[model samples]
Target: MEHSKLSLARRLKLQQLAIFEKVVETGSILAASRALHMTQPAVSKSVHELEAQFGESLFTRGKRGVKLTEFGVLLQRHAQSLLADLRFLADDVNAWSNGVSGQVVVGVLISASARLLPRAVVRMHETAPNVIVTVRVGSNDVLFPELARGVVDVVVGLLPDNQAEGTSGNLTHVPLYDETLCAVVARDHPLAGDPSIDPHQLENMAWIVPTQESAAWRSADAFFEAAGLVAPKRLVESVSILTNLELLLESSMVALMPHAVAEQFVRSGLLSILPLRLASSFGKVGYTLYAERTPTAATQRLLQTLHEVGESVRLELIANSPSTETR
Candidate 1:
């Protein structure tokens, strides 16, 4: 009798998926085997079996290691989602058995990493101590896809400018608070604490701007345009908050930052906010999640804590502002 090929639905095994995912992640079957504490041949066999079942080559072997084929990339996406679901299931079961104990990977933009995320983590710790939290920081472009793909439980930072922007439309944002932009300089910069400093004069000096593709850059560019000026001729584009902070402290460069982020540095005497305020550039700060996916219990608790922290932050910002009107 002749044999028939098994459908992928019937052929797929969790073990094979796990092995394949590890190979993709490490970029080499041998490296994945080492990481998994399995023999290299065993890993290679599993990958070969997966390729046979799928009727496609998953990786291209190279002297350096391996690279995912086009099909490999596609499979990796679904594999990651499946693995994430497995983790969520394990966490869910553990929570039911022990307590609210699980892990959540959170993606954050620079703004949220400064204050909002830390405060919320501390609050979550006081309550759900067993809920382990991991944070990955990046721009909207990097975090949004991760959120949609289930790699991240939630994302925190400035909400995207619009649904049509460079973000997944399936994700939904919850506005926590509003934040405006403020120009900042090194504490010893020539314009530091100069109440009469003009935006036009700052143009002659070097400036640090967000990366061109980020939502922050769009808002910042609009801010400069509103002031009837182009971005400074001498500009350094970056998305790294730490690098930006260091650059501001070490040079005469001026940068625009979220008001809340600037206040933290200002309080520490590391950076000084320029007297200029960008009222029209108010951006919403909040957390985002996939619209269709139901959040695990641990994620729900974290979200609740974030809301509480957000309210406190909103109140604090209102109290500090000279104008009573909310941004």
Candidate 2:
């Protein structure tokens, strides 16, 4: 779910969502009204008004009760995520008001999904139980713009080469660790039987390609170029991580994944590393911010946890992947 879109400020108001949810849960305006300690007519009017605003019939009522129409089902997931955010906002407003007990939105990347973000989030929660977190995961092509727009407080991922220190920008970066690109295939893949596979074999195989603008894709392109070979011509372009993972699991498609991300899946026997190393280097891996303003106490605490987690991850990578080194 893209919780960023679920922010009530973008669309429906909080009260409307609350009323809409009650009707959905109780199956009828009368039942919802009783549950909410309001009159049945008021509940009915609210539902009718919302349905009119949406310009669609959200429910179908019958003797057996009510059922959601197609549009209603489509909005169900968004509603849940949206309502949760609203409640999170309410909790934040009622907190100590020291800014340490509110919601914080963090933009994440697939590279950090398997390890970095989760570890930092757990540690953050341990200290600030009242703090709520909403993580928005995407490639730098998508996340950095959001960070620049102030929609995201911080981005946790490998800094794109164009945004590096020597390059000009208002963004502030903290390099937490380093990682390298590696190839992965299904556990039961034909090449999985051999610890070492020739890089040229990738040319003949299908590939789950990342967006051309993404750092992962650029890294893979550079790697293939350095090997004096054309990158796999048979490409499946999908920005979704799980979709690519599923394709790798069930098909002959080879995929490029950061060593940190691929390590967990490889260790669990869900995927196999190609045992191929690359000379193409990735830039510093860490959080990037818009630098114009200071983060709240809650967000700063989370950033602190991320730095700590990054140190542990960096040491772990050096001990595990021989070719990886910090910048």
TM-score leader:
1
In model 1, the clashing pairs are: none
> Which runs of model 2 end up more than 4 angstroms from their true locations?
1-100, 162-168, 322-327
Give the lDDT of residue 285 in candidate 1.
Answer: 88
Show where candidate 1 strays beyond 4 Å.
1-6, 162-169, 322-327
How many residue pairs clash in each candidate at the backbone level? 0, 0
For model 1, what is the alpha-carbon lDDT of residue 161?
78
**Clash list (residue pairs), candidate 2:** none
